[model samples]
Target: MDAAESLRLAARSIRGHKLRAALTALGIVIGIAAVITFVTLGASVKAEVVGQFDDSPANRVFLVATPGDDGGPPAALSQPVFTEYDVGRIGEFEGVDRVVPRGTIATSALSRGGETVARDQVTATTPALFESVTFREGGAFADASSGEACPAEMAVTPSAAALFPGNLSVGDRVSITQRGNRTRNVTVVGVLADDAGLNPLAGFGSRPRFYLPTCAYDTVVTSPTTGTRQNVYPQVTVIAANPGDTAAVQTRVQDYLDTESDAAQLAPGSYEVSARTNEDIVERIENVVDRLTQFVTGIAVISLLVGAIGIANIMLVSVRERTKEIGIMKAVGATNRDVLQLFLVEALLLGVGGAVLGVPIGVAGGWVAVTYAELPLTLPLVWVGAAIGIGLVVGVVSGLYPAWSAARVDPIDALRYE
Candidate 1:
């Protein structure tokens, strides 16, 4: 038979046993859908997670003090803190352009226009931190001179600005009560863009944050450690003058922290200081996501194999049931090749049908998951194409033996069979 006639006959046979055809194709549908859904979701999650760190400047390096070999608790816990002395010396390092002290204090409450919101974070860093940050409203806090105190200025994140009855505007005064019971009033100078220079560690964007100048940080919040001075920083972010010099700068900073810094002299074996570039951290994170995606995709591939077996099983049964029909076709001068083509075409139709149904279902499933998780949606078009190809391969391979068996049937025995 010609290709078109073969297809017409195969389609007629499938339609004649609609329920059996549907059942036979179900495994392929599930397999393709599983592969597509996981791949799409994996890509989307990876994109969303990596995108958060995109704003991090390539020249930036983060410094942290850990307790001995232990990484220590979150930066807020102040296991071994960097002091103002460390920040000043790091800034003077050969390739260091600037150093921003990353000190955060837990606040009891934030008050704006008589409305109160509870338990948020207020971070203190230098005005230089905002150099590349985009603001949604107003502008960066006025640069505080070296000798003068910071100008009671603060910047609020968009989430923070909307915490009150009415959205806070530039120049609005707000009171922040720190966990230490110290209350400081500061004017809002800027509001950060929703996606601009976000803290990657902040789980979702809903948490409110207020930024203050490092000079004013001590006046508002107490140090997390009792004996440590208020000037002690939980962490420090360093910007290298050039991206290529980042490694040299990191080495110099670590060497100084280990040998010359006060924390080094005081704690010695009890604490360790480490400086790492943004690129290093980001690469580590990407590696983890890639491994997870590969692992899940492997699981999906096994399901596809199961689908291939299902196709093979159903095709064998199909060959047995169509024995009489095959004999009549052969009696009418049909060649073995024609009979094989007809059976193969039927399997292909089933596989293609499942693929067509599966792709949309998988995409819809991925979209729903990402939407519910509030993550960026990414469609893995490559996986979609692969899924289609996989279906076709499964059809041909699974139907091969069955088609051969049907073609080998003798006309005399088939004709006499009930």
Candidate 2:
């Protein structure tokens, strides 16, 4: 028989037993859907995370203090390691354009016009921190470089501004309560643009925050052992002189902290310094997502195996039921190759149908998941093609034994026994 004739015969045989064919292809549908869904979701998560850096400065590097492996509890958590002196010295390093010390102060509430919003902590950094960010209202407050002390002016993110009854604008005075019930009223000098791309220290997601000069939080972060107020920092941001020089500057900053910095001089082998760029962080996040995708994909492979077995089982039953038809076909000058082709095509059709159906289901599944999670939608088109290929291969391999059995059946016995 010709190839088209074989396809017609195979499809007619499948259509004769619609429920059985549907049941047999269910495993394949589930497997392909699962693989596509997970892979698409994984890609979307990576895209969302990496997209956060799209607006960030390429020359910015973060210097963080961590505890050494030989520690009891985390030393950096127990005591402040990076001081104002350390930040100043880093600013003087070669290839270093600017350094901003980020310190957090325990805050109770921010109040304006009898309206109050509670807060945990507020970040304190220099006015230079806002140079790269766009302002919606006023500009960045003047730093001490202008022959005046850092002013008691604050910049607020859009999320922070929304916490009040009316969105905060320039020249608005709000009372800030710090640790120990220290209340200080500061003027809102700037409101950051909505898409300000203000990356917080330690990889915290974008959220409501207010910024002031590092000096404002001096009394809030006093040294525990010394009982004295010090402008200590857990994180510092350094900017390289040029955009592409961050890697070299990061290396130098790490080496300096390890060998010559106060953290090294005061307590040797007790503190570990980390200097990382935005690209470094994005690469690390991608690696983690890739590993997780591999692990989930492995589980989906088991479902494919079960699907292949289902196809084989259904094909075997089909051969047995059509024994008389096979015998008659062989008696009428039908070749063994023709009979095998007929059976294989039936299995192939089932697999291909399952794959085609599963793709859209998987895509819808991925879309719903990402939408609910508030992440960007990313389609795994490459995986869609792979899934179809997988289905074709599965059908061919599963139908092999059944097709061979049908081809080898005795025409005389098959006709007489039935």
Candidate 3:
């Protein structure tokens, strides 16, 4: 018999017992589906995380404070506590890019119009921040002029703007009331917009922004001492020369801070350093997700292996039941290869068929996971292709032993047995 005839016979056999065929391929279906879904999602997560740097300049870096000898908690690390000089010294490094000295004013004040909300660190930064950090709504401020009070003007985040009439427009006024019943009225100047897919306002205690010039601090911050201009220290922030240059910048900044006679003088406590590039945190998240995808896919494959075994067993039984038929075919001059092809085709069809049907099932499963699980859907294309390939290989290999056995039966003994 030709290969075409063997394939036809396999097809007809599968049609004759549709339910049995479907049940036999069930494990393969589930396994392929699981694998495809996981790989695709994993890849997507990886891309999303790395994308944070898409809008940044080739080189931009952010530096926060190092804890003092008595480190406040790990959570405090994120707290705006770094000195402005720390960022200044970091910028002093060779190949160093411009640095944006920033400080987040942390304290709530009542606005004159009764739009009262406790704002988290009200940031005072130089215009250099425009290149350092991405905005999702309004823009950042201009460079703080030396010895000049920061403009009464401020930039607001979309979330922060939502609280008032028409949001914080370029000319709106916000009042910052501080201790001793004092208040400072500041004008809104800019808005920021971004597509990093993050909650644009996840920071600032979930309140909207009211960006102010450093000079605005004079109104809210009472000088703690006789000679200090403002009590707020800069939360060290630096823009990188390029994404690739982050490691170099980090080293330079660390070395600079370590050498600071003032930094070394900080109250004795363990000093820890942590740096996050534009995409570093996101990459970390994606890695954890990819690991999880692999772990789950491993479990699904076991079921597929079992299904292949079932196929092998079924083919063996068919060989036994058709012993007389096998002998008759041999007597008619049919080669062992022809007999083997017939059974092998059937097994291949079962495996491949299951895989084809399960792809859509897996895609639908991913849809459900994204919508309900609240995870961003990320597709891993390579994983899907591998899953399908695995299915076909499993089918062919499982039929091998049974097909070989059927082909080896002796013609003479088989003809007399029935």
Candidate 4:
């Protein structure tokens, strides 16, 4: 018989024993569904993380401070104190475009009406930092062009502005109190948009936040020991001249800091200066996702193995029950290859049926899980294809021994027994 005839016979046999066929296919359905669901959820989480990184500044590099050996704060003498002057010096580097110093302090805002909003995260940065962010209200960081000792001007997030008494509008003035009762009256020159893409403290739950020019921030906040106001920024963001030059610039910046005269004054390894690019962050996140996916996929593979064993068991039972029919076919005209192909087609049909049913179920389950987790919804097409292919392979391999046994049956003995 031709291959088409063999396939038709296989279908007829499957339909004839509907219960057995369904039982055989149940294993395959469960395995395929498990694999698809895990793989889809993993892909969605990875996509969400990568999307957040993509939303950040592209060509920017971050300079972060690492703790000292004892796990306490770095020794004061060894501390790499970053000031506005250091920002200017870093900006003078070959591939450096702009340098923005960043510092944060917990402060309370006292509205002009004497009402206070406390526990606000106040950031000190330059107007250049505003270039990368969106503003829901007003313009860029209020320019500190007045040359006054402290230009009391700031920008506030919508959430932060709501904390102040009265309608917080642009051009309003509020008093900010930092540690040690240091206070400064500032004008709200701008309001940050709600969707300010990746801020440093985004991982921390939502809190009131505002931005002030570095100069203004230094004036309102003073060092505990110095008793004099100085620009003490904890982190410095270096914007590379070109996106493609970030890596090279990062290297140069690191080398300069490590070997620079002022930096050399600190003890070796007293404090470590690390630079991270957007790509670096994204790569780390993807690596973590890949490891997690592999772990979950390993469990899914176990399910597939179980399904394969179940398929083999069912196919073996089918072979024994159909022995008389097999003998008759052999006696009439069927060759060993024909008997083998017939049984194999039956297994393939089971696999195809499981794949058709399981894929949709897995997709629907994945969608619900991702939605509940608040992750980006992503369809893993590659994993879907893989699931189907795995199902077919499992079916073929499971039917192999049974098919072989059927093909090798002695026609004369089988007919006499019947």
Best by lDDT: 2
In the range 83-155, model 1's lDDT, one tens digit per residue, is 7777777888898888887677668888886788886678877787777788889888877656676688888
> Using TM-score as the measure, what is the rank order of every candidate, best first?
2, 1, 4, 3
CA lDDT of each prediction against the hidden true structure:
0.78, 0.80, 0.63, 0.74
User: Model 4, 156-185: lDDT tens per residue?
Assistant: 777778876655778887887876778878
Poorly placed runs, candidate 1 (over 4 Å)? 1-8, 64-85, 134-153, 180-185, 193-195, 198-207, 214-235, 250-274, 295-306, 326-342, 400-413
Q: Compared to the true structure, candidate 2 yields what TM-score?
A: 0.83
RMSD of each: 5.1, 4.6, 6.9, 6.1
TM-score for each of the candidates: 0.76, 0.83, 0.66, 0.74
- Candidate 4 residues lying further than 4 Å off, grouped into runs, are 55-57, 64-89, 103-126, 139-154, 158-189, 198-235, 242-247, 257-273, 416-418
- Report the lDDT of model 1 for residue 156: 84
The candidate with the higher lDDT, 2 or 4, is 2
| Local lDDT at 79 for model 1 | 42
Ordered from best to worst lDDT, the candidate numbers read 2, 1, 4, 3
**Residue 148, model 4, lDDT:** 57
